[model samples]
Target chain A: MSAPESILKAENLVKKYREFTLDHVSLNIPKGYIIGLIGPNGAGKSTTIKILMNIVKPNSGDVKIFGLDYKKHEKEIKNRIGYVGEVQYFYENKSVTWTGKFVSQYYKKWDENRFTALLNDFQISRTKKVRELSKGMRVKLAMAIALSHDAELIILDEPTSGLDPVVRREVLDILMDVTRDENKSVIISSHITEDITRIADYITFMINGKIHLTIEKDDLLSNWKKIHFKKGALNQEISQTLSNVKEGMFGSSGITDNYLKIKDKLSAAIEKEDIKVENVGLDDILISFVKGE
Target chain B: MIGIMKKNITFFIQYIGFLYPLMVLYWFLRKDSFDLPAIMISGFFFYLLISGSVNILESYEFKNNVYHFFKTLPLNAGDIVRAKFYNVLIAVFFLFTANSVIYSIIIPDKNMQVFSYIFILCCMLLTLNIIAVLYIGFFSIGFNKMGKLLWITLILWLVLTILSVEMYLIKLDANLLYAFISRINRMVWVIVTFAGFASYYGLMRIAIRQLEQNYDNV
Candidate 1:
C-alpha cells in the first residue's frame, strides 16, 4: 500500500529573534487530514505557521505547498491556501460586503454566492463595518473568507483562542465540515488539547521551538496509559518506562507511553488486580511533554 | 496590482471630500493676487500639504495593520509598490490639471504663459512626489525610523524648493523667461517627460526590492 500524499511539507525551518528562536521546526500535512499543532504560549507555534505561509521568511528551511517552492510559486501557493492568522487584521472601516468583494478579486475560484451564504450562516451582517463586529464575529468573518476561496489547504493559527464555548464549537464544526471533501486538509495551531483530540486526526506537540512528537490521535491515546500500582509492587525495571510518577498515601500512579510493550509484562499483575490501568487523554500526554517528564 | 491601486484610490477618496474643497477655497480666496510666481508657490504649497496629509493617512493605515492584511493576500512586493506609485501619479495628474483649469479661468490674459509655467512646475512637483512615494515604501524599516527619515527629507525638500522659487522670481526677466520657454524644442519636452517617467519606474523597482527584503518588518 502507498502512503497518503502530503499537501504541505516543511523541513527544518529556523527563525531567529532577539528573545525567541524557532529552532529547526518541521511539519508534514497530509491530504484529507486535520493536523493539530499544539504548544503553549510563546512556544513557536505562531512562528512556524508564519514561516509556512511565507509571511515571515525563515532563516533556514524549505517549504513546499502543492510540491511547489515559495520562492518561485509564492502567489500560486498562497492562492490555494486559506490562512486565518492568530490576530485577525482587516480594513476596519470597510463594510463586510466591500471587504468580501475586495478579497474575491485575488482568487481565481472565489465563489461569491457561497461567500454570501457563509455570511448568512455565520450570522454576519453584510452592511456592518469590520470594527463594529465583535471578536467572535471577526473570527467568523475570517473563516467565511477562508472557506469561500475553494482552497486546497486551510491553515489556522489559534482560531479558537479567546472565544466563547458556543462560538468555538461552531468554528470547530466549520473546520470539520471543510474536511468532508477528501482532497482538502487543515493545519490548526492551538494550546487547547481538548479541541485537538476532538477533531484532529494527527497531533504534533511542540515545546521550546522544537517539535517533540507527531502521532496519530488514536495511536497516542491507545499507547499512553496511566497505571496506578502500590509501591514495590512494580519493580524498578518497569518504573523506568513510566513518567510523571506520583505517590499518594493510598497508592502510586505513573504514565506510560509504551503501554502495549509493557502490557504483557503486567498481565500477571492485571490478572491478580495488583495494578489499575486507565486510558489517558491528549491533555495528559501534552502536559507530560511540556513539564519535561 | 489593480486591486491594490483601487484600494488606494478608495482610501484617498475618503479624504478628498475635505481636502479638495479646501484647496479650491484657498485658490478662490487668493484669485486677485494670482501670477506666475504666486500660482507656482500655491501649487507647491498645496502639493506639500497633500503629501503631508497622505503621509499621515498612510501612517494611520499602517497603525490599523493594513500591511498585515495585505501580506495575507496573494500579492508580491512589486504589486504593492507599483500600486502606490500609480496612486501618486494619478493624484499629481489630477491636482495639476485642476490647478491649471482654475488658473486659466482666473488669469485669462496670461493663460498661455501661466500654462507653460505650470507645466514646468508640475513636472518638478511630480518629481518631488515620486521621491516621497519611494521613501514611504521603506516602511518595513520600522514605522518610527521611516517616519523620522520621511519628515527630515520633506523639510529639506521644502526649504530647497522655496529657496529656488524665491531666487527664480527675484533674478528672472519676463522676456528672458518667455524666450527660454519658446527656445526649448517640443521634442526636448517629450524626452524630459519620458525620462521623468523612466526614473519614477526605476525608483519603484528599488522600493520593491527593499520591501521584499524586509517584508516581515512591514
Candidate 2:
C-alpha cells in the first residue's frame, strides 16, 4: 500500500546552450524499477543524463542519488552510479583487457571476475583493440563495464541506438536482469518506443526539454486507447476527453487517455455496437505527443 | 588518481618510443660538441621537442573527447588535474636528472660548482616548462587554436633560450650573472625550489576549479 522510494530525484534541472535550453525538467526514479526516458533528437535526454552524472553542470538544478548530493559527495555518488554515454569513448589503441584494467582501478567495488565473465558472455575479445570492435560490440563493452562495478544505479543514454535488433534485445534483457535484484535501478534514454515498451516499468515522455508525461507502463497502455465511432456517437462532453481526433468518410477516430473514465459514458454506444475501442501502442501515443496533438 | 597517472605514463612511454630514434640521431649528430653549455642547450632543445610532440598528442586526445571517458569514471576534477600535474613534474624531473648525469659522465672537467649551477638552472627550467605545459593543458581553446598557440609558444621559447645563451657567451656581465647564481646561499635555493613547488600546487588548484566549472565547454 506504500509507494516505492525514489533512488534518484532531480528537481527543476536547467541547462542552457547557445541554441537550445533544457527547460525546468524534473524526474524521480523509483528503486528496482526501469525508467525509460523517451524523446526525439535534441529533446534534452542526453543533457539530462549528463547533468545527472555530473559530467555537465546545470545552470540551475539539484540532483540527488541515493540521498547524496553531487556537490558534497561527488565521488561517493558516482562510485555507485554506472553511466554509458551515447558514443562509447575509449583509447583506440588499448586492448579490451587493458581498458577494463584501467577502469577497474577507479571503482572501489569493481568485481574483476564479474567483469571477465561479462567480457566472455558478451563475446568481446580481451586482446582486441577498441577500434577493431564493431558498434554493437562497443555497446556491449560499455554495458559490461557498467554492470561489473556493483553499481546501484545504471544510467544509459541511447545505449541501443543503431544496434541490430538482436543486439538491442540482448542489451534490453541485460537491463531487465539487473532490475531483477530489487536493489538496482535503471534510467535508459532512447527514442525507440518499442524497446522502452518492452522493458520499462515506468515511461517518461519528453519533448523540447520538458517532461510531458510520466506514468506506469501498464497504466499508460491500458487507460490510453483509440476509439472509432459514428459521428454522433461521441458527444461534446466525451469528445473533450479525447485527443488526436481524426474524422474520415467511414467514421471518426480519436485517442482517449482515460478510457476507464469514459467507459460507462460510452456504454450505450458500445452496447449498440456504434463505437469500437482498440489498444494503442507507445509509438502511437508518442507520435500523437510529438505532433503536438 | 593513480589510474589517471598510469594512463598518462602509458601515453608518455608510447610517445617516447616513437621519438627515441629521432633522439638517437640528434645525439649522434651533436655528440662531438658535448660540453657544459652545449649539453644544457641540447637538453633544453630536446625538452622542447618532446614537450611539443607530447602537447600535440594531448591535443589529439582532447579532439577524440577522451575527457568524456574520464568524466564518466568515479573521479572528481581535482583527481584528474593533480594526476596531470604530477605526470608533467615526474617527466620533467626524470629528464633533467638524466641530462645532469650524462653531462657529468661525458664532460671530463666535471666541476662541482658548475654542475651545481647547471642543476639549479635545470630545476628552474623544469619549473618553467611544467608551468607552461600545465597552463596549455588547462586553457587550450580548441584543437586548431591550440596548434597555433603551441607554435607561437615554441617559437618564443626557442628565441628566448637562444638569445640568453648568446648573451651568456658574448657579454662580460655574463660572469657576474654566474657569480650571482653561485653566490646564492643554500637557504635561498631551498626557498626558490619551495616556491616553484607551491606555484605548481596553486596552478593545479586553479586547473581543477576551471575543469569543474567548464567541463562541457572544455
True contacts kept of each: 0.67, 0.75
- Candidate 1 scores an iRMS of 0.9
RMSD of each: 2.6, 2.7
Tell me the spans in candidate 1 whose CA falls farther than 4 Å from its real position.
A269-272, B103-137, B157-178, B181-188
Q: For all candidates, state DockQ relative to the true structure.
A: 0.73, 0.78
Taking all chains together, each candidate's TM-score versus the true structure is 0.92, 0.92
Candidate 1, residue A96: the lDDT equals 100
lDDT of 2 by residue, A47-77 (tens): 9999999999999989999999988888998
TM-score of chain B of each: 0.80, 0.78
lDDT of 1 at B170: 91
**Candidate 2: residue pairs that collide:** none
